[model samples]
Target: MSSIAFMTQAQEYMFTYSKLFSHLKQNVKQGHEDVKVGLFFLNADTKKNCVIQKAWMEKEQHYEELKTTRYNELLLPLDDNLKSANPLVFVRTPQDQRCDFSMVVMTKQPLKGTVSYTEVEMLLPQMQVMLEDLGGMFASWFTPDVEGVTLEFQGLVDGQVEFSNGKTKPIVNGKAQVALSDIGQGGSMILPQETSRVLPYLPRAD
Candidate 1:
C-alpha cells in the first residue's frame, strides 16, 4: 500500500502581537488610561502542556526578553507597557494541531509603584478568567500558523511516524495521509526512512 506519514521534528512556532499593540495604543491614547499586556494559551486542552521556548520584545535593533510567571502566561512589564515594543513568543505545542493562543492588551487602572510577585500571584486567577473571555474578541489580532517546511511521501506501508509538533502517526494502509489544513505550507509529508520511499509533489489545497 502507498501512504503518507507525518514525522515529529520539534518545530518552532512564533506568536506575535503587532496588531494588538496598535489597537491598545490607540485605546490608551484616547482614554488616557493605563494598559496591561499579556500572552496566553487559551485552549484548555493544550495551554498547560504547551512549551514556551522564549519570548521578547522587539523594536528596530533593540530586543529584550519578557519574563513569564507561568508556562501559560506572560505579563508585560509595567514600566513601559507596550510603548513601541512588538512582542514575540516562540513556542512548541505538544502535537500538531490548531493554534489557539491569544494576545490580551486590556485597559487597566494604574497601580502605584511597582507590582510585587505576591500581588501578581494573587491576581492570576482573575486574570486567567478575564483573558479567556477577551480571547474571542481579539482573535484576529495575530497570525495563528506554525512556521516550517512541508514535505510529502508516497509508496509506503502500514507503520508509524513522528511529526515535527511532537505527535506520532500510525500508517494504517499504504495510504494514510496528513490533511493540508493540518499543515500550513504546501508540499508533501515526511515519512520515516526505514519504512518507505516518498515522492515530492505540488501542494494541493484542502
Candidate 2:
C-alpha cells in the first residue's frame, strides 16, 4: 500500500524508519542499492525502529541509476520522547501477516552515556512498559499483505514509514553488561557501541 493508504488503515501510520530499517536490514537489500553507493543502513545498538539507509551516492537522480532513491521513499519523521527516554517498541505482526508500518519513539541522540549496571537494570522497568504499550497500539495495524514492521524515531530520527519487504535481526549479545565511566567516550552518537541491548527483530513488509 502507499503511504496514504497506510495512514488510513493504521493508527500508528507515521513512524521512524531507523529501527524499521535496522530490524529490516537483511530484508532491506542488506547493503547499498548500488555497489558504488557510500551509504548503508545504520548499525545501531538499540532496538527502536532503526530503518532507512545511509548512502553516499553521487546525489544524481537517474531513471536507471537506482542509487539511494530505493530507500528514500521510506523515510519519515516521528515524535520526540523516544530518545530522551531511550525507549524501544517491539511488535510481533498479526499471526501470519506482514506489518505495513512501524511507529518508534525517536531519540535525539542515540544514548552514549556511561552508567553503572545498576542504571540499566533500573531503566529496564520503564523500557518494558513502553515496549508493551507500543506493541499493543500497533498490533491492530498489522496486515497479511507483507511481512515486516515500521519503526520511526522521534527524539533522534523520524520520517515516513512506508511499506517494503525487508528483514533484520536484533543485535543481541545475550550477556548484558553495565557501562563503566567514560566507557562511551570513544563512540559518537550515530555510532552507538556501548549500548545496553541492541535487541531489534524485523523481517519484511512481505
Candidate 3:
C-alpha cells in the first residue's frame, strides 16, 4: 500500500480503539456509582469507599491528611444545613457513543465543612439517600443524545453553566457546565504521527 493509504488505515484503527475503551470507562463509572449508592443504602461503608476513590484519583501523597480533610469537607452531610454549599457534578466524555458525554450531578446541595469522623459517619445515611434520589431522577437527562460541552462560569454572577458544541452559540442553563476540552474542543486527541502500535488488537494489514 502507498504511505498515505497505510496512514489512513492506521488512523481508522486507532479511532475504533479509542471508542471501545471510552465506552468501557463510561459504563464502569456509571455502574459503580449505582453500586455504591445501593451498598450505602444497605448500610455499607460507602464513605470509606469514597475516601479510597479520592486517594486513587489524587495518586500523590495519598497519606496527606489535608487532602483527606478537604475531601470530607467538600462532600458530606448531604443536607441543606451546610453553611456554604454548591453543586458537585462529575462529567466524563465517552469513548464511543452518539452522545458527547455522560454526567452525574449530585444532590442540589452537597455538604461542605470540617466535621469529626463520627459526625460524617452519622450523616452517611442522609448522604446516601440524597445521592440515590438525585441519581435516579437525573438518569434520563444524561442519555446518549445530549451533545454539548458544559463549562463552569464564575464571573460577576454567583455561578453559571455554559453549554456549547463549539459551532453555534453557547447555551446557558443557569448551571455550571463541565468543560471537557477533549470533546468540546474537537480534534484534541489526534495523533501526530502513525506508529506500529495502532492496530494492537487486530491483525495488521501491513
Query: Which of the numbered candidates is closest to the native, going by highest lDDT?
Result: 1
Clashing pairs in 3: 22-95, 150-177, 150-178, 151-177, 161-175, 161-176
- What TM-score do all the candidates reach, one by one? 0.31, 0.24, 0.19
Model 3 lDDT tens row, 3-78: 1111222121111222222222332343333212211100032112122123111122322111223222122222
* CA shift of 116, model 1, Å: 25
Pick out the ten consecutive residues of candidate 3 with the lowest summed lDDT.
195-204
Residues 1-206, candidate 2, lDDT per residue (tens digit)? 11212222332222222443333332223221211111222223343332332212111241111232232223322323333332223222222222344333221123333323343233333333333333455643552221111222234232221111121123223222222221232321121232222222133235
- Steric overlap count per candidate: 14, 49, 6
* lDDT-best of 1 and 2: 1
Question: How high is the CA lDDT of each candidate model?
Answer: 0.40, 0.27, 0.23
Superposition-based RMSD of candidate 2 using all C-alpha atoms, in angstroms: 17.9
TM-score of model number 1? 0.31
Model 2, which residues run further than 4 Å from truth?
1-114, 137-206
Cα lDDT for residue 113, candidate 3: 25
Q: Model 3: residues >4 Å from true position, as ranges?
A: 1-74, 77-144, 156-206
- Model 3 lDDT, full chain set: 0.23
